[model samples]
Target: MSALVNMAAEVPENPLVPPIPELVIGLVAFFIVFGFLAKKLLPNINNVLDQRREQIEGGIEKAEALQAEAQQVLEDYRSQLADARHEAARLRQEAQEQGATLIAEMRAEGQRQREEIIAAGHAQIEADRKQAAQSLRQDVGKLATELAGKLVGESLEDHARQSRTIDRFLDELEAKAASDSTKAEAGR
Candidate 1:
């Protein structure tokens, strides 16, 4: 046991510190790894960072361009809408004017037709009155001839004389009626 204790105490001169050769070898290995990373891996990382930055900037520029195009399209749509509205208004106004013109023409045609109808009616009434007067004259002449034949005890068969007597009687009757109407107007 004493021998074993002496060997363990002699094996390590200082327990807190490593041997010099081992420390030197470890420091050299660490420097070799750091140099390899700086030479090869660092440049690759820098290239990736630069590529990502460029992509982000391009995306922003593209988004801005798209936004501008959208704004232009919106403006064009608004302009077209305004033009359409104006055209619609103009068409409406034109339609109204045409409608008014049509109405006027129709009204004038109706008035003309009314006047023609009234004129035709007046002409028909005049013709009917003349026909009735002629018929009445014939009837009265016949009755008068019959009465005269009965009173004088002879036939009134002379056509020309009978016509002249009837015409004279009608003239005298018309004159008497006109004078009576005039006297009535004066009295009123």
Candidate 2:
């Protein structure tokens, strides 16, 4: 009975639990590995993370600066465009003014030339009329003198006497014609 009780009491310990020695050795190895990783790899990982953070921040700053520069350039370009538009408008207005002035000057010159031509034409007509009237009067006077000499049966060869006779005859005829026109008007 004693031997059986001792065998039962010496039965294998619980299978769920590890031996003490192995547990102790495993804990030591785990501590050593954990310490080495914490000391050696943790700082390196932190340094890499910090470097990545700095790079991201630098990239953001650079992008912001570029955006600001782009904005400035856009503003400058807009200003230059406005100035160019203003200059173009001014030039167009000036050109229009000059064109209008030139047209006015040309119109004035044309008007002056037209007036001068009209005056010259009127003078030329007056001169021609006077010349024609003088020619007709001379021809009439010559015919009258020839007729008078035939009627009188005497040669009126004196030029001064012939002129005086023609003048007297023309004055009497004009007076008679005037009296006849007046009488006709009164009868109407």
Candidate 3:
């Protein structure tokens, strides 16, 4: 106890040095301030950060859902495109078949028309030939009658002689007509 009193009496008091009591008071004040900030400010900041994290996560979930929906729509559109392509191909085939059928029908119709025209022309030619033969027969008969009158003028008055003359004239006319018709057909 005497030694401790001697050490205390030898220590010098300085205005620049803080006392132990003052140092202890400053430590207590700092602890209180830091404790208050830690309990109140840090928790509020954490809550705000947590809220932001939740919002960001929810936004990401919504974005993912939207992307999935868009993918489904794209798939559906691709399927529809394929179906449309098939339909177009089917229609093209049908159109080609129809066009070919129509062409065949038109060709058949044209052939029929051509044949009908040729048949009509042949019939007209046959009728004209018959008319020409009839006219030729009349003219030839008149010429044969005149020739017979000159060849056997008085003999033709007899019935038997007239019959013979008529038979000979008809035979000659038939031969000439056949020869002329053959020549005409060969020329054609």
Candidate 2: residue 24 lDDT (0-100): 100
Q: Tens digit of lDDT per residue, candidate 2, span 1-188?
A: 99999998899788899989999999999999999999999999999999999999999999999999999999999999999999999999999999999999999999999999999999999999889877876888899989989999899989999989988887898799999999999999
Tens digit of per-residue lDDT, candidate 3, span 1-188: 99999999888878798999998999999999999999999999999999999999999999999999999999999999999999999999999999999999999999999999999999999999999977876676666666878876643456566556666777887899999999999999
**What lDDT score belongs to each candidate, Candidate 1 first?**
0.92, 0.94, 0.88
Which residue pairs in candidate 1 have backbone atoms (N, alpha carbon, C) closer than 3 angstroms, thus clashing?
none
| Candidate 2 TM-score to native | 0.65
lDDT ranking from best candidate downward: 2, 1, 3
Q: Report clash pairs, candidate 3.
A: none
Give the per-residue lDDT digits (tens) of candidate 1, residues 1-188: 99999997777678568789998998999999999999999999999999998999999999999999999999999999999999999999999999999999999999999999999999999999999999998998888878878998988799998888778878898899999999999999
RMSD score of candidate 1 (Å)? 4.5
Error (Å) of candidate 2 at residue 140 is 2.8
